[model samples]
Every structure is written in C-alpha cells, then in structure tokens.
Target: MSHAPVFDAVIHAPGRLQICAILSSVDDAEFAMIRDAIKVSDSVLSKHLKQLEEAGYVKLTKQAENGRQRTWIALTPAGRKTFAAHVAELQRLAALTAPEPMGQGFAG
Candidate 1:
C-alpha cells in the first residue's frame, strides 16, 4: 500500500518472515499448510503465529470441516501494509550495500 519503509522486528524473524511471505500471497492459509511450507514443527509455528497475533498482524480462524476444527491464517490489513513496508526497507538497505558497477570506480 506504499507505506513508508519500516524495520519490523516482529516480522524480521526468519520464520515469521517466511510465514508472512506465504500468507501475503494467499487469501488464507491452513495451519498445517503453513507449517509444511515453512518446514517448522507445530509448536514452532504456533509460537511464531502467537507473536504475530499479539502484534495484531494476523487473524486466525477456526472452522469445523468433516468434524475437524481447521485453523486458517491470514494477515490483517496492518500486517500486509507493514510487511510491504518492511520488505521495502530491506530492499532499500540492501541497495545501499550493492557493489558498484564494473569500471564505474576505475578512472580510465
């Protein structure tokens, strides 16, 4: 949403980053699907999710399907905005460290 770049410590964690990246592209994702995509244990994923939830970055929904309660996760509007900003900030920072073009530094 063209938000100002921000460094979000909560989303900066690798696991959480992956989670956000995955969720950012989808309308909603299942808990097990995310867990498998990120290759983390249930508890590990839950921990990361709780952190995002605490920050109001994600919304979790529980539904009954075939007598099983399925949990679906999605990023809140704020989360999407912040994630975009955080990614932008990271891009900006990475650009700062980019190497100079070949021969640009050489005074021929």
Candidate 2:
C-alpha cells in the first residue's frame, strides 16, 4: 500500500521546523542548545515549544544536572514519523516544481 506524504502544519513554522530538524538528528537535545542553535529568544522558543508540545509532537523533561535545572527536548514517535513525512512531502514538492531543460517540453 502507498500513501501521500503528510505535511504537519504544527511543525511547519520556521522555528518549529528547525527544532524538529535538530531533534530528529538525536535522541534528545538540551533546550538551551536548541535555543542557541535556532538563535531565538527564550520567550519565542518557549512559545514554539509550547505549540509543538500541545500538538503531541515533542516531549519535554526537566531535571537537575550538576546542581542546575536542565530541560531536554525530544521528538515523540509520532513526531518523528510526522517530521519524516513532512520532509518527504517538501522534497516531492521541490521535485515537482523544478525547472525543466530550456525549450525542451513544447512541441511545434
């Protein structure tokens, strides 16, 4: 069986998208690391994280690390699958929109 790729709007925003990209590459990442990598303010990142969390696309955990509270973020199984499908859909769209050879498609 085959199905069309799924595009997740929740993960489509630039910041959220970048967050998913980073999380997809690892089992987990520190919230600070993600914030720095995405170069967004705490409130902005927090807002995006809240949205993603509401969509059940990400999991957040807070714990003590070296006498400091650290927050870690990771994609849920659903998140990973949705993100993969979203990427595939984007690739498909790019392929469909790619320019063809000049003057090669018209018939006289």
Candidate 3:
C-alpha cells in the first residue's frame, strides 16, 4: 500500500534519515553496524537515536552476547509508516522540480 506524502523534520535530518534507511530493511540492526553504516561516532549515533526514540520512531533493546552487552535497534511501526510517507513526499516534490523531457520544453 502507498503512504500519503508527508514531511517529517525529525526523520529528514541527515543522520536520522540514514538510520531510518538502514533500519527500514531489517527487523533489527546492531548498534555498531548502524554507526558504521552511517559513519558516525558513537555519541553522535546515540544522539540521533535519542531523538528518534523520543519521537516514538525507534526502539532499542539490549541483549547479552558472550560476556558483552549488545544493543539492537529497530524502527517502530509508526516509524516505518512515517518514513515511507516522508520518502513519498520527497519523491513527489522532486518530481515536481525535475527537468522536462528532452525537446518537451523546446520553443524552436
């Protein structure tokens, strides 16, 4: 199903957008993996995640692996839906500004 286009400032930020993009395709992603994918420092990723969490768009879980604690991240259902809508809106707006087809705008 197609989602209605809607602009979401929270999800639109560069780091957050990248996080959402990564999370959108997976059931859950490891914290380090996401940080690596986005090429951000741990603190930066943490900050971005905090904002997303506050917005109710992401969920964080901790699990024990071996002797270390690993954190996993996933997008909430609301996040998935909202992200889809935001992407649709971006596409819609992009299409509006896209150049006309070759020769379509020619006056000659």
Which has the greatest lDDT?
1
Counting clashing residue pairs in each candidate, in order, gives: 0, 0, 0
lDDT of each: 0.97, 0.92, 0.96
lDDT of candidate 1 over 2-104, digit per residue (tens): 5889999999999999999999999999999999999999999999999999999999999999999999999999999999999999999999996989878
Q: TM-score winner between 2 and 3, please give it.
A: 3
lDDT per residue (tens digit) for residues 20-73 in model 2: 999999999999999999999989999999999999999999999899999999
Query: Please, what is the TM-score per model?
Result: 0.90, 0.86, 0.89
* TM-score of model number 2: 0.86
Q: Name model 2 segments beyond 4 Å from true.
A: 1-3, 100-108
lDDT string for model 3 (28-106, tens) is: 9999999999999999999999999999999999999999999999999999999999999988899989698887886
Cα lDDT for residue 35, model 2?
99
Error of 1 at 44 (Å): 0.4
> What lDDT score is found at residue 36 in candidate 1?
98
User: What C-alpha root-mean-square deviation, in Å, does candidate 1 show against the real structure?
Assistant: 4.6
